[model samples]
Target: MGVYGRRRCFAVLGLATALAVGALSPAAASTGAGHGAVPAGLLERATVVDLQTAMHARLLTSEQVTRGYLDRIERLNPRLNAVVRVNPDAIAMARRSDAHRRARGARGPLEGIPVLLKENMNTADRQGTTAGATALLGAQPAEDAFLVSRLRAAGAVILGKANQSEWSNFRGSDLVDGWSAVGGQTHNPYVLDRSASGSSSGSAASAAAGLAAVAIGTDTDGSVVYPASATSTVGIRPTLGLVSRTGIVPITSRHDTPGPLARTVTDAALTLWAIQGADPADPDTAAAAGTLPSDPRTVLRRDALRGKRIGLWREGHVGVDADVDRVFDAAVRRLRDLGATVVEGADVPDLGEVTTEHMLPAVLTEFKHDLNAYLGATPGRHPRNLRELIDFYDRHPDGHDHLLFDMADKTDGDLSAPAYRAHREAATGAARRAIDDPLVRHRLDAIVTPTSLPAPVIGRERDSAPFAKTTTHAAAAGYPHITVPAGYAANGLPLGLSFIGTRSSDAHLIGYAYAFEQATNARQTPRYLPTTR
Candidate 1:
């Protein structure tokens, strides 16, 4: 960057920090799961499936449904900032879809569901996708991204795009989890001061807040699961190839996956189906058939968890939040009460074997290639290339298109260097080695762990947030993992337990998750402002 640019960054940050600290300003409402109360209107309203039923019965119009979510975001999102850009045309789009519904029965299982997608995902509509950065503010793809096509085919109302950590948090080190240029920092609903783990921060917050029935998020490492757990919601990270990544903002293709976030497992499972399917454009997803289920996702067998053999792998990087552990313990007992064969053991497949030695260069190279391909093929407005995107950020220092990890990023030397080449091989090797094989050797249906190390800690440093240490294992393995609220901590924050399995075990994992969720009805609506002890 030029000398003047460097000086300006320091100036901007100085002002932003000062503002962030001196704020005790009260808003009319809050949706930050980290520190605010759950909106009553959303909870009292219909669930995701209920929206479908209403549409089918002619009780609600798709346009009306879309308008409702938009209204909710408008009424409540300012306090949480979970939704960065409201789709100004959402109601119009919904009206068009409503015309289809009137002519035919609902087109897909998700018909009329108002769903929020991470801004990184491309859509054919005029909606802009910047990955929560100011750099690509004007970049709206002409054609829908792969998964977006599926969502549209499913008749979902693409409500609005959510905020995420800038560039999926790959821009630099020392990044805050939920700070996005477009949306600002998303506050956790349960505790306002706690971090809203990113880079899918807005997805998690939006789902937990009841702004939408379900929201979609992407994970490179704990991006979805960690944030879902932190915010007391169900978020699933399907096996790597289970969902298409064709038009998503890039991080590492090897670990990136688009998943669903919802208040309940059924809602999440439904959204998952809508997004899954092989995309010829994305070769990685060609193998999706083996990993995803064709079964309808909204159906739940409440007794599915009963009489099942479940392996509890309690040893991971879980920070053992006192409130979280208490919740987990109760959940385990509920499992037993429900007639599940539960085994608690700590022989998780790998810890030291896969991590110490690593390969990341391979992943970064793929990221550049895959991202470039999407950018080139995308029809609408967007950065012509990654290099141009970086340049744009340089020209516009606005937070709207910026999630700053490092001002030094613009100065990083040539990525074409041999050192960069070697780095890719090392990181890929480590990821492949550390993930999957262990689950295979264990021969388990699903491996379970506390989804996160700690309950959301108010004002905790982003560096301390558990993502790689807790989630990268499953991510690297290319396996399916789901998080369900096990119970609430004494502090009233939610604690989550994760269900992970090998690549093709998505169905089994969901079935198991459903069973557990039924056995332990631990999720409770947040009261917005709980009295702190």
Candidate 2:
């Protein structure tokens, strides 16, 4: 779902609530424990349901829940380095929430919930709008991103920001997935030595470790869902524009959008609701609002598949990790038992090769323009353009801008302004046709495929840098992508099943995820063991 942990192109952008990380007992928070304990009055260990229950019960104050997550971050962040810089002021905000609850009574579903966000997502508060760059490390947006405001309106406590691949890993090749100049590298919660796929590495890792109940992350390509797949969590890449992109760091305007990462489907849904809406700041929403469903919660029925036609992408079965395949097969069986008509086939059209042939150029061009505007617009930022920002990185010693193992010269990658418009039109138009014609031809609900290749072999696996070109196809089309936990690999890493749909069908797409989540209930908490054996 990403190309970014959530950054750059200067225009790069991006919440809080009073919510607890959830029902984990103090003992469960201990990595040494055999079974993690789920505490009373919070979300059930891996789902959003109990978090709502706990907040409603008044058994836990938002401050109590926020403190619990902050406590976990204190205990675990040193090892994982997932959070770039936590807001020192978060606890105070929670205390205020607690006082409000005590005096005025509870407010809403997330009255006392805490949620973390990717650093690139702008918060008007103490956090900087760096986009993983040392150049912008001191810059904070003049105002909260629209999505963050929504979360605040919902009574969420703005927890902290997570680390990500610098510039969302858009600096050419050989960029490590979770490394950011501001935060450094984010280690996988399940395996410290192994890679956590970007650009939402921090969101996935922290959530997997139970550092927070839910987090906001942006996905351009596989950024959100892939990390969830790699980390064994649920990542939803909402349809383009379902969530406003008024302040998110840019790749291509078409594909860049923020999303949610959580232990379960319902949690993602909760986060999604808080963020989804039209914003006057971004014109994209005018079209998006028309295409999106009004209320997803009602349509998210547990037995949704009881009388439905479901098609499984057979492409995922081949060359997949054995453990991941095992979970996938079992998940399919469960869907069948839930009363679905299941169809399995390797029949996806030849659109696979389109990723490289048509999309990468669009991102490169759009990135230059979008980033410049973002940098110029940010309240305290000094760099006015991509070249200036890159130059700033070179002069600064902080690791923020020095990400790629071989940083391509900015001069080589920079495109003239006209290129952005020409490239955008060609790429987006093609993508729209490819997505629409196929869905209309097949008369399908959505197309399902593996969220990512099987989770890489732990220490035994090789870490390959991603291609900038890879994410463009989807980004250009502005379609929605949803990834659900299908099963686990033999090595125990989770496998994500992605559902791609026509533009603006985010609710319908997430509905399938919600239904499937209820049907399979396959999500698992991380063990955080030193070794997988």
Candidate 3:
């Protein structure tokens, strides 16, 4: 996952402020395994499928499940800073879900499940959509974001908003991944002092700690998958148009798309199924017309990797930490054992050019336009345009980074500008070629790489350390990217393996990821250590 900060430093997308399912229905999730009282530690590691089965079997009530999550958040969030706010009406929503389940049946897989949303996603309710910046504090959205509305319709309990990188880490130079002026810092659950690679910091951390059943996060580049990798959870960055962007804070309309972070591939797929569809508000979603499956439950299979040709992007693994390399080597062997033909040396050609050129200018140009429109339409007294936003940040400079915001404000905010249009076109073309060329040449079903170096320590030391990531091509191409727990570093930090597929191949990638996840069973519940020993 390439962060937006320090993109210039690495020439490979860094976050220096810029730069960058299916599913079974609720009824089908049960394998008849649930009985009696909610299993011990259910809230800590229960999959959405597990919860649905328990609720369907009358072993657990939605309110009880909701309460379980609330209790955990109450006890753990102060230290993790993962959940920024709790919905006062969470129980009420859960109770309503219970009443519905009683009167009829489960609304869907997400019915009554508590979900944490990245704070940038607008929720027209008690929770604030601050995007982790004081500038937007108390800025109530006029309505739920398109995805949020879909989740609510599917009967999900809006548990609360998870903290995130301020302005999705787009406001400053040398931005810290999980630190926000409004929410403070979110600690990685596994190793508190380690970075929970963000801007979706809180969502991935919360999902890792089971603070909620699952979480929603936006990815312009590495935002979603990076943190999920850092926290050893599942994160899917869908093909851009598969999920609507309406109601979420903007980064670049070109690449920003909200997706799921969950503990299991199954949960991630189910969450995607619940919230994905075409929306008139987001014209990009027009491409999703026939892309989504009616039932993602059928998409998952234990043998999905069998007889498939998988390519290893070893360029992503070279010059990494030895421990991470060892883990990735083992993961490659495991893929082979599971019947996938592992094609070595399948690196995306011309990656340096893809990374160094086109992206930043296009992103900055679009951010100016999109944020102005979003703020103008939003119901708040906050700055309604880019200049005003820059001025707001300038007035309150303490602990804030506004260099990137200032850069964006200087732009004319015109998508039709020749310079902006040229960069946008070239960026997408290069990115698409980087991913598609390798697949066709190798006859590969998908490409695999290490999602990221295990979460780096938080602070100055990380600046000099290499930030290995593999999300850029997928992000820029507007294709599908999914990360799953692969192994752990010696200090107990989580490692993730990523699967990248061509555009609109989300279901196929999910199936492959699920197969690998089941084969390895590599994920271990976080122990909440104060630091890596």
Candidate 4:
């Protein structure tokens, strides 16, 4: 039998063993203890604009900013397990940034900012690009991801790599969203027993807990937006190809894109602008050339939504949680009060059948093809292909490093298969039509929905009933999706209001999201409570 059959057998046997020993405790499995007291006012919720002003006024050095964040990470990360590794060179890098500002003034928009990267983004630094996998622990790429280089050139200090869902949550069906064997489980900052969501778990949690000024994450589907919603942060999944994917770990080249998660829409917009550009290494980025605005911040007006037609997508006939629905309705009312014309039940063609039949199969084929290409290019002694990765797991069946899910199923079929090709084409076509037809029909500027239900309890394998289905539509259409904090649930959990626009409509989407954010001003910093009572 191949790895799937072996995995089934091992799981059956291991279930008993795991139960006997009891599944790993979140606290006991953590790497270190929480340390340091919380920082003083404004620092916790300070935006990029605030930090820039402080630096320009000589009120704070980059080193001091970096050290403060490092202290926050040291204090909070152990409990949240958000950051995977702290960069040894971070202080030194900040010192260099300080020197540059003193000698030549601010280099660019992101000058002297501290940003954390999702672990999957390759950085040719002291930190490793592990993707939260022990097997690839020491695998460092020869250069930084195109986006990371852009951040460096803009004078942002690279704080370090944040934890991620192992292999971007493609390893198995039973895999927990935010739990990676390499990093344990990342807990929500608001409530320690709740999940932060993943595979962008660390990036979102870090931003929410004030461990970093901003964080970068990659989204295949809901990885970035869902986690941002869970943590009450702003996440922007820009139009695919708007940001280069080269030098980052791959899941599917077609659906994969880097995004920004920050405490405010302005900060997220600034980070998006800094990283977006055409790169020859990734030919898809050619489409984004001249399409994006010169500065997305220019569109951050409180009046941006005035006279715009916004679609309120109520999941059609599907039911959502009563509390979540109540919050979403309030958000729509707020939009109307802000001068946006809200269109209820906008007639978007449903792509549910297409997603059920085609999306997963296409993802499976793309994962095998694209990941092998990425692995082949990397310099490492680790598994070079999906098959080798499965074999590595097989060798450690009973060890702490054993795989939680079988990847062999994803590698089962060849990309050349006619079934796979047909599904891929059908899914892409359906997704585009589903989103585009609605906008054209309704004359809508954007579509709005809840980014997700309140985050689920931690350690649960999946989210409970009433999950949001909107992310698939945007992800498959390769459109821009922005999520801003809407309100808190009765349980004190946060919910997000998503603004999704057609492909290459990132500037408009950001404008709308920023406008709503300015109007609502709903996001609240986490209290880091032990748990929800």
Candidate 5:
């Protein structure tokens, strides 16, 4: 099995019923919530823009919103298993934010906002950076990940750590999507017994459940976008070099990136702008020196999709379920209504070769090399390398899966290995061409497809649904890909529409997604349903 099969990206078959429009309205626009009168369900549907506006107008305070999120997490996290640790200093940070705002105006886009970090990110704080592995239970890093530092500098509160798949879902051959030894399974908030579709599982679920203003997730392949699709949130896998990866638990340095998940595209874009830039530590970020915009939010107009050409990518394992196809078809029609030209048959070439021959080998080989480097640099009495980590799991094997770790241990962690270099070059070249060629030939601004099938039942046998082929090509090419809430399945599970672009087109893709989101309003707040029936 390749990355898709190992990660369990398949969804269960269900009835095909499309929802019309799904923006959640405030229960009460004037309700007292410890601060001034605040809108009820503020945490559930409030955007960062909304929160900031409310705070600036003195209708809400930073402390009130922070406490509100804390209360929600306290109530909902037990059932969802999305959070692994709560920052003991989160409320203090929020009060400090209030003080700062009281002295000077708000700091930036994320000022006074609470954000969750995936457990794989090293935060140099009270929480453990375990990557959901108990082997590194007490291990800590010397400093926050580069992006986390940027977030703090922007005056955002470090809310807590969200659980993720152990070792970012590269630990075993038969790994469940959201299962981790340290944090247990993450239940999809839309349907509690369904898969959250991780490595970035908890981040998506928390964003969907309004556990924080937004959450950061690390994507190697489908980790960020896949989970966001399953949870009816927006996820952006930026150009790999756009975000610094220093201090993150690695699957492959070439493909690893931290991205934001939120209930709206504008919020995700704002969070991405705050956390993105060049880093002295991760030299790969140097490639992004001039690629990013002054602000991604400048392109947030509702008519930003007007006159743009979009390629419809429905080839090779993309159209999986009848319901998902119906949802995607409606999304394409909406795009046309919004004045985008949708060109059909924009398939990536040789997808099979990219998945099997190139992507798998490079992922396996680089995981060993990159993870060993990260482990060596991290502080504490834990596994020093992949080999040691495999032994650690061998000693404590309950709920831990390390078959992939064993595979990595057998390989010499040498980047210059003859086959390794060849595979990496071949994979990068082919995947890049797969995305770039389609865009150039179609004269397209972006490629559109169904992000994934709707959320599948947890631990259920894989059905015959064709695998959704959305994230891998963008991941391998180190390009930008964003997934937005397109619609829902009959079971109330969310479906996503993806927009993929060539290298460093993050701003344009975000603009396109934002427009679609505004036109469709397709993301409803989760119902926490026990089952579809």
Candidate 6:
């Protein structure tokens, strides 16, 4: 027996003993081994390209790669709680990939690669699209999400779903970012006790920990970028409509888009290439038909930063921790060294005011309307509307259903309210103006900022400081945002630098991110430390 056998035995025995003595807390029980270590070479920090090369060289079969990742998840997921479910048919899927390679060669760049989807994405398979809610645990969509279908066509194995914040954190404002009734809480891989910022918490954590080659996540606001920053991974929130949102459990149609989170910018770009296209099911995607480049990978270049004008946007935001600030400064210096013309103190005036005053109301209204539409279409004996969902929680046998937060407020709203219409109109104009004006007036290719403050400690304080100020402008404007690992803080937690560009500028943004990622090479494989000291 190797590491896998030994670790499995230890976990099973440890969990059994803990339960026998009535000493296991819910968190401890969910995290079985108490340590998030994985054996070296099992699935440690390997990129999708690396895996593809190995598979094509006949050194490893897709089945072997798939098994290795499954083994890694089994050993480490109990502690990280990143992946809630493992596909029972993953090995079978891999076998099919191997067969295809043998009979017809690789189907696409992603052929045979194992990937995890955020739980909100519908798979139309054994896995459920619950969005981490117990109420929808048995519900399944009649078809795969458009993005999921794209991944399948590119020969990706649907390994399973990563856990997400319940209802993509729309359940209530008071709930912790990663806590879900069905999947427990996702822990940051670098420090188990810190928050894995959601609602794409598991996707970021799993990608960081090498649980999969790549993972897909949904970003309505900072969900994708925030968690990626926290976990030291690359997350690309593509331009709105760049990737179809059809079949996803919605928070808001206005901002919702499925994006790729990966260990490297190239990997993320490849995933984006696979998923970006027109989908008749999502009318928004019609705008993206000719907007995307022929190939995103073609834009990846070491010289991508040369002669580019990048603006450092820092105005109208509370500052980051001193360590994070240092990291951001260093990143700026590196960009300048790479021949980029950096503009200082690039301000998006009234960004925060506009987003706060206009964006929130629009999101609230759209969340109620879009979610009701999705729930009505999903199959199963589940709540068909927001009102019924709130009632379900109220009557839950688990008296602790509302212990963290209540969803009663979301149940009372409808989209036709005049106040909501006004907010939507104002938000649309303000967001577009705030984002577009800066790029146009400054003649800048992209804007850069620290993605977030360091991840906060996970607990019941219910009033954690906001950490995503840098992300809100781009999120509200439906622009492309790419977050690359910047550096670790003094306490060893990760931080990220974000690259934001105008709408439909995904390829250019990716080029800048790829250049910065190549130059800094800041990301480090997580050590799974118990805590930051």
TM-score of 3: 0.92
Candidate 2, 177-225: lDDT as tens digits: 8877778878777667666788888988888887788888888777887
| Model 4 Cα lDDT, one tens digit per residue, 396-462 | 6524332323433444547788888898899988988888887888899998888788888986636
Which is better, 2 or 5, measured by TM-score? 5
Segments of candidate 2 deviating more than 4 angstroms: 1-47, 102-105, 290-294, 345-357, 396-422, 457-473
**Which 10 consecutive positions of candidate 5 have the poorest summed lDDT?**
10-19
lDDT of 1 by residue, 1-533 (tens): 11111123312223224224432112211111121222235333356665565455444466655666777788778877889877777766677676777776567667767889998998777777788766577676777778888988888888888988877887755457888767788877776666668888899989888788789999988899888987878889998888988878877677789999998887888888778888887777877775654564333567766666566665543433555556567667777787777776633545453343343434545556656666676655667666766676577655333323222233232446686556545555555544444445544456677777544443355445443355766777677788988776666666788887666777778877888886676677755553344
Ranking by lDDT: 3, 5, 4, 6, 1, 2
lDDT of 3 at 519: 94
lDDT of each: 0.68, 0.67, 0.84, 0.81, 0.84, 0.81
- Model 6 residue 53 distance off true place after TM-score fit, in angstroms: 0.7
- Show model 4 residue runs off by greater than 4 Å: 1-39, 316-319, 347-350, 398-419, 461-463
- List TM-scores for all candidates, in order: 0.82, 0.83, 0.92, 0.89, 0.92, 0.89
In model 6, the Cα lDDT at residue 462 comes to 43
Predicted candidate 5 versus true structure: per-residue lDDT over 1-533, tens digit per residue:
11101222111100001001112112211122243322346678777876776555444567777878988998899999999999998988988887787678688878889999999998888887999988898687999999999999999999999988877878887778888888999999999989999889999999999999999999988899999999999999999879999989999988989999999998898898889989999898998876766855467778989999999988754546888889989999999999999999787766676667867787888899999898999999899988898888788877646788877777776899888888889898888999999899989999998888888888651553667567888999999999999999887899999999999898899999999999999999999989886
As a TM-score, model 1 comes out at 0.82
lDDT for 389 (candidate 2): 67
How does candidate 4 score on lDDT? 0.81
| Candidate 1 ranges with C-alpha deviation above 4 Å | 1-45, 297-299, 317-319, 349-357, 374-442, 454-459, 463-468, 530-533
Q: Give the lowest summed-lDDT range of ten residues in model 2.
A: 7-16
Candidate 3: where is the Cα deviation over 4 Å? 1-40, 353-357, 460-464
Q: What would the C-alpha RMSD of candidate 1 be, to one decimal place?
A: 12.3
Backbone clashes, candidate 1:
33
